[model samples]
Target: MHQEKFSKSTRTNKQVALHTDVVVVGGGLAGVCAAIASARSGAKVVLVQDRPVLGGNASSEVRLWALGATSHMGNNNRWSREGGLIDEIMLENLRANKEGNPLIFDAILLDKVVAETNITMLLNTAAYSVTKESANRIESVNAFCSQNSTYYSIFAPIFTDCSGDGIVAFNAGAAFRIGSEDKYEFNELLAPEKANSDLLGHSLFFYSKDAGTPVEYKAPAFAYSQDEIDAIPRSKNIGAKDSGCKFWWLEFGGILDTVHDTEEIKWELWKIVYGIWDYIKNSGKYEDVENLTLEWVGTVPGKRESRRFEGEYMITQHDIVEQKRFDDAISYGGWAIDLHPAEGVYSEKPACSQYHSKGVYQIPYRCFLSRDIENLYLGGRIISATHMAFGSTRVMITCAHGGQAIGEAAAMCAKLNVKPKALLAPKLMSELQNRLNGLGHGLAGIPLTKSDVLLKAEIQASSTLALAEFSQQDDWLSLAQSAAQLLPFTAGLAPTFTVQLSAQEATTLTCQLRVSIKPENYTPDLICKTIELDLHAGEQTVSLDFSEVELITQYGFVIFLANDKVQVRTSAQRVTGTMSVFNKVHKAVSNNGKQIAPPNSGVEEFEFWTPERRPMGQNIAMQITPALQSFAVSNLTNGHLRPWLGSNAWVADLSDKAPTLTLSWPEKQTLAGLRLYFDTDSDHALETVLMVHPEKRIPFCVSRYSIKLEDGTVLMTEGDNYQTLNTIYFKQTISTDKLIIELSHPAENVPASVFDIEVF
Candidate 1:
């Protein structure tokens, strides 16, 4: 109906200018977390994402699962899930989309971003240029959206680059490295002997489904032929059942430039994907594939490695392996140094070489600040880490965890009217850590900030869990592989444990009491005592006495060596801060019982004692001579969230009916908000995609809860809660001298547990 007049040779699209406290580039999980954290911290945030939807690698387009410190629960880091905003996203995803439908995940992320009033999300907007106020500071970023034909000029004092390719940082003259570092540069044994351009590659995935009837497939001209497909060293791994990320090894373009060569990489990956489908359909190798049809295939490849910007301090291999402590520590990581072959799918070498640390390690705040650009925060995989350290920190969840820290720092900077590096001051750094910890971000060895208001109140629970026994159930676990029961110990002589066991034949069981060298860690590196028990053919009770050995307060592992002839009883009772781990193999993450590294690889060799996922992984049935009094009412005010040096949670006795925690003060106090931390079985890896979880809600999470006054007036009632952090803000401030929190057990067999309670 309307016609536009003719324009000059060059014409510009619609131009828009925006001003905000913080601007975050990229829409990956890391950037999403960064924007959310900043917005929640009272900063006006503008989140610029180049894609149509958020969750870069984790989006439906790429379809890679989001994982972090839990490492699929394939390592020794127990209760190691990254906390705060990332935890909320994963738990929410689990509750709404535990089946891991990529499309559903996309909706969840979009919902979370849009719900934040302080956040202005600009999707499909790519920040292509950077405008600097000075050589070291970025004044604004210039972005464009081709779909809308719009140009956006976003001005902010603080800019965070969560982009996987370091787009903004690159344009802003931020120092970055794109290749591996020399071994001697950082004295990193895991580094290459000489610096090289080799890096992890890009990968594409396809999904197939049964049509209930025969479906035919025809190969396009670009698809690889049988002779070409046969040339791949790992072509034998292909099967009819494999789909999506299960074929993560279907990678390419590592040797080529990952950033500039992305399109070329996508084409090669497509050729490989279509070629594989063609082989399955026509090569007559797979039988059941006759009814299978290609359901979905990735349009864009997921990039693993690209540009790594320079920060004030670069984490190295030794920092990870030795579990180095940083004064400015803000976050933690536990995934192994997983490196893929540069040759990708065509290489004869193993698909990946992974070396795990003994336990979780700390990441310092200096690693998030740009070395050259002031007011710039580096986030995601681009954070300052050497090639070796990046191997572990490059995972999506780990990046997102660090992204929360970056966002918080940016908010703090805006509030203080200073540059990002100014937060490195001891007092400011402590404040930053406290803020992150208050939000439930797990920092190794960092205690929660003491609340003076909460301290003045007297806390009492209906009944505290006593160190007694996990009642034996009908289920029995076979001892075909080594198994261990993780238990909390006091700072004295180890207690005696009596376990019920049945033997297929008379056998001798070797029991060892072990603890980690570091009390804060769960790895059983130190063997305190060993005992041998003789078992009969029939079921009998056996005692493992380690009373002679004195130990510090920590989690002790009562390990039973593998004896195929014996089986141990399991308990239906699920307790907080307790789990049974097995020395087994998880082929997905390449964990094969133990990690045996090559000599001089600078990697430590340790056995992987990981917990099994639920529906299984029941605690071993055992009775103690002296009840361990680790879980107490005082633990509620201990200023620690999760299971750290000890069980930092107050767990109610299993027999207590209508469990409750009461906080009483001498005088009436005004309360506007209350924050509660619940046990979400942090040991369980909540993978964002692919794997199916047993329960939509964590078995140990509080399903229903109510907050009431001493007069019995209900303040807040949560009927179905599945998150780790529950913040309740009253519609109006209430004044009360006493408050009661009534809780229901998440599961019949699982006791009610809470880490900490804060009132504001």
Candidate 2:
């Protein structure tokens, strides 16, 4: 090998020139996703992050929990988890760290980016300068890494601005709006009467730990007084165990510029945090906080709103509320229009104003590409949307989905050697949608029709379909002293309930069925039915048939395992429409020598857990029949829109035996692969605010299935699937005119639904 000269003749330190197919600025969830998506699609990518960590607000520095479609759970739009790369990250986190630890999640995100060979990550590098070849095309971006005191000039054919602040777009001279839009501009009721510079503001959160003993506290110089705390409307919401984020109302600098005044905003937030903590501990009002101490406080305030770049289409509040369908839709969002007052903590009103959508809304590809810059794309919170619309789409999961779309689009642009605007062509847009759908990305109303042999065939199913799972099983569950499983029940009468349990040793146990007076909080307050039993060491079934128990509200079944040796059986299969609740127990015993049970004393004391809630992956086992319905088999190839909770997919009637679906074509067609999209409760967002769901796969997913060609020719038999999308490629090409699919319910007497089926 020949070696060159050590130094250049002209300069001491020169800029490092790095070339890539695509350059992504910022390493937040959006940037990470963009880089990953691009790399996966055969593009050389360079991901530049200003911070050392990958997650932006979700990282340890900011400590904001990831939110997305789950934000609209109680607002009629349920089970709307952002699919694709975001889902992959969530599922990986659920498998590794179900506790939702930010540090562990940070590592998970970092590992995901680093694992991609085509992605070159430059942490601690900030992109500040943009080089454009023409008026509309960005040629390169210059970033400085202060850690090594090195300047990097990264050249790329395509660029994605996933930076939450839209730094790349701003520097590239892309047209963008800094604040709210006028109501008349977008015809949005939520928008201000006239355009304003007010923003959603920034926030910093802190966590507290129990010190086991009384801890003395001193107020800082800028600490807020008890009188000042009393001025706020929701001051009573704070508690000893409450985190700083819970007081999201503690925001500031909305009236000021969120970017230029960031430092000022951060300083003010710190003062507020210390003041809030001081009032809670030293005010002598909250005696329960005597043992708690501040464990960690965020230095960098997590930003909510900033520069929103202009694109071919600007999403408005009407699009979200009406749930508009777009022909070029690439991703979807379902979070309610959660708009907060500009006067954060100072405001006397509630923290936010929420407007829910009829259901999840589709985000079009037109919103991802910059209107003026041909080579530039926008993602994350900076996508093209009015302030009111951004309230829903700005969520991290939605941003992550947007990032994935732009990444895929960037890869396509680089491959085709065309500008992003070129992809807007009908044929190209369809190709992009098909590719995204094939990869399990969100495109609500758009069906996968490109080269889909199943789309051209006639379909028939064996029986009428069921919308939801109708089976119930008694499985094993470990019960804490203050734990209660919440299930949806009719309010009028107490029906016969059957529960099976097994004890390690002979023990006495009490089972109480209580009515949740506060359905919102899911508290087991009023006792409707109770049963006392002496459980044996082995398995035993207890049936309680109560007559005329006046149930006024939703029901919660609480099991009191007085003896630590007893364990109740819970359904191993996940029930999508129900939820469970566990009370926050500081100690096993109460002030008296009695074991603590749920609905202990206060209204906000219990931690409610819903079905598909993360961390607790499995649902509580109970004896009840789920409502069922019949669905068409043709819906299997009708695209990936779950309009109602269980409406879009092809639902089969409740059957213990396997049901068959047949696809017949007029003539033999060459087939190389097959793709199946199952109904795994796509609407049920499977991650939790504090805990991750234990299992990503639902009971309705086709765990066991077989496929055969015409004349009884075996194609694939006895296959298992656990993901939302399952793709199978045959080793050898198979030519067939007809295909038969046999599916079995994973649970007893349950129904299975096929969201989409494709033959390539």
Candidate 3:
């Protein structure tokens, strides 16, 4: 085992190296993001991390799932988020591991940190000291690695301490505090009955598997009940060997001593962890399953409480419980004030409560910077906050947002050659807030240079700018990944966000985000989505998928279940398919034509149509032609449907007796055209339906021409035919909303079992 320890060093005074504008200590999520922000803003940066990987708790070290305000339902279907480096991480994961339990989270974090050219990362390094010429300026930062015991210096104008532990801040001569201040500090309702229980806890999480066969295991000699176990009431039933997760075994983080007792707590944690398994197998809980054992043991203990330094804005519990919003709020969090009760130390039930506000609450940027220290900035759990406020804001994922905010601020300071506190000023604070608002997709653009006045600009080649602005009191993490990108580009927050494009370059382009719960949308390759954006033409606020990412990895999903969020790299040999369900009907395509009912095979499924908002009739028409079955195209949002909502993968059923159709193909086959027939069964509200060919197998039903039924007129071909080979088109030309398609044209020999169709 590689024991991570600092070696003996006698040298206190050492020469420091100078480079870059900003130096971020602690390469966790916040540090990584801050580095990216600084580097992207055209400032050089050197990122130092004690550990080898990035992402802090979200990294592989702890392996806790990414938890923010997520709209996820077990990793299925489609979703979106605000884009940035986090979006990039998510997109990479989608490209590598599509299904849930995204395993490559560590690699994804590392890749982003390494990909940027302006940022230099120093791994396996620790920040030992921060030398300052004055409180207003950081002269140098010294880092040491145990591997070499040599101190390396990094000098920068601004320094951000994203080291959740607040080690750097303390070294920088910044006054810091640990534990709770007063019960009224944050005005939290669930604070300690009287005084605050300044205790913060951590857990040793592990993954367990069920053993099919019974196995006996002996406990260690010291594995006996003590005051620790006696105090807290154990369910005695929480541990189940068959269960895949086993955090219930967490028995650390009580009063003996927070830091000094770490090793002892680790020892006690081990006993309870293995003891539960011992009872499971010996106690007969393992009798039902097959082979079972520990799959993974927690490496870095999940620390819930730690040191916190006073920041420019000391976020109070009242700010959270009362839903206090700030005009300069850069990020939002509203997960609820969940207080885990410590039952062992005080001999009382552990405190656990769920508190909700009328709406989301915004976290101000001031909470990220040091108020006393001139050049110091704090991120993650150690940011300036009262005990109760930290209780709500200290979550890893939410803290990551704090990390991102500070990182960006650090970048902004470096680029502007200003201090982080400068950002707290009204003009700068509002600008940063506007930038965040744009990134959140809540508000658009920096509120600089009013839109209406831009139309009368004296400059030549000026387009009529109708920019209007609206701001939402964003307090939900659901939109955390939303609007952080606009400033560096749209507004002058980062200033370098301005791009000088060639005249030939299309103004319209797809903007991919970096991190998201759903990774399918983000891509290293610039996704060539049609551009219709009228920037500088209109000033309007709209919610969009600009920062949302989608991806798929080919080898990750062994057998993809419907609605599973997936990502895949396009391969020439790859085969794909789609399926949809409607009111009382299911539709798909096949080699010959659209199927009346989809084949009852793994390749396809059938669903009967039901009444809906658009329209419905006795049946609906489905079309499959030679034109479909083989094609390479960017992923589309609407091309298929399923019995359940957001099912990315779907099975199709083609049945003429009912409003259902299906299509099938061996591989990529050349198809001429495709024809879809509709009955509007009983509705006309349906306007358009898009088609996607997952299999890339062309449909052979329609020859080289198309047929249009517009105005009840049959035509040899409907509209324009493009370079589409395997896939073809089907639009509602009948001026009606719904349709019933079938493969009754037996002469075409089309089986109607194609699986690529989506109606949105």
Better of 1 and 3 by lDDT: 1
**Displacement of the residue 589 alpha carbon in candidate 2, Å:** 34
Q: For model 3, what is the error of residue 416's alpha carbon versus the real structure, in angstroms, after optimal superposition?
A: 1.7
Off by over 4 Å in 1: none
lDDT by residue for model 3 (1-760), tens = 7774675865454444758788888876667777776676577889989887777766666654544322111111112222334544443454345432424667767778788888888888888787788875568888887665557888878888888777788777676666556545444444554654446665666666556664445655665433333333563435454332235326456454555566777676666655655555455544553356656666676566667888778887668645565767776554445455554322345434334332235687778878777887887778887776776677655566666666667777777878777887898877665443322212111222222222222211101111111112221111111111210012111101111111122233222222211222111112312223322322222222222222232100111112111111111111112211121211110111111321321111111111122111111111111112112111111232111111222112122222132222233222233422111010111100011111111231222333323243432442322111123344332232222222221112122222123221
- Shift in Å, residue 556, candidate 2: 26
Each model's C-alpha lDDT? 0.91, 0.72, 0.45
Candidate 2 TM-score over all chains jointly: 0.74
lDDT of 3 at 677: 16
Q: Using lDDT as the measure, what is the rank order of every candidate, best first?
A: 1, 2, 3
Q: Which stretches of candidate 3 lie over 4 Å from their true place?
A: 1-18, 71-83, 98-103, 135-137, 210-232, 235-237, 241-251, 254-260, 343-351, 437-760
Query: lDDT per residue, candidate 2, 431-485, as tens digits?
Result: 9887877777856546556454666788888875432332345445565443455
What TM-score against the true fold does each predicted structure earn?
Answer: 0.99, 0.74, 0.56
lDDT, model 3: 0.45
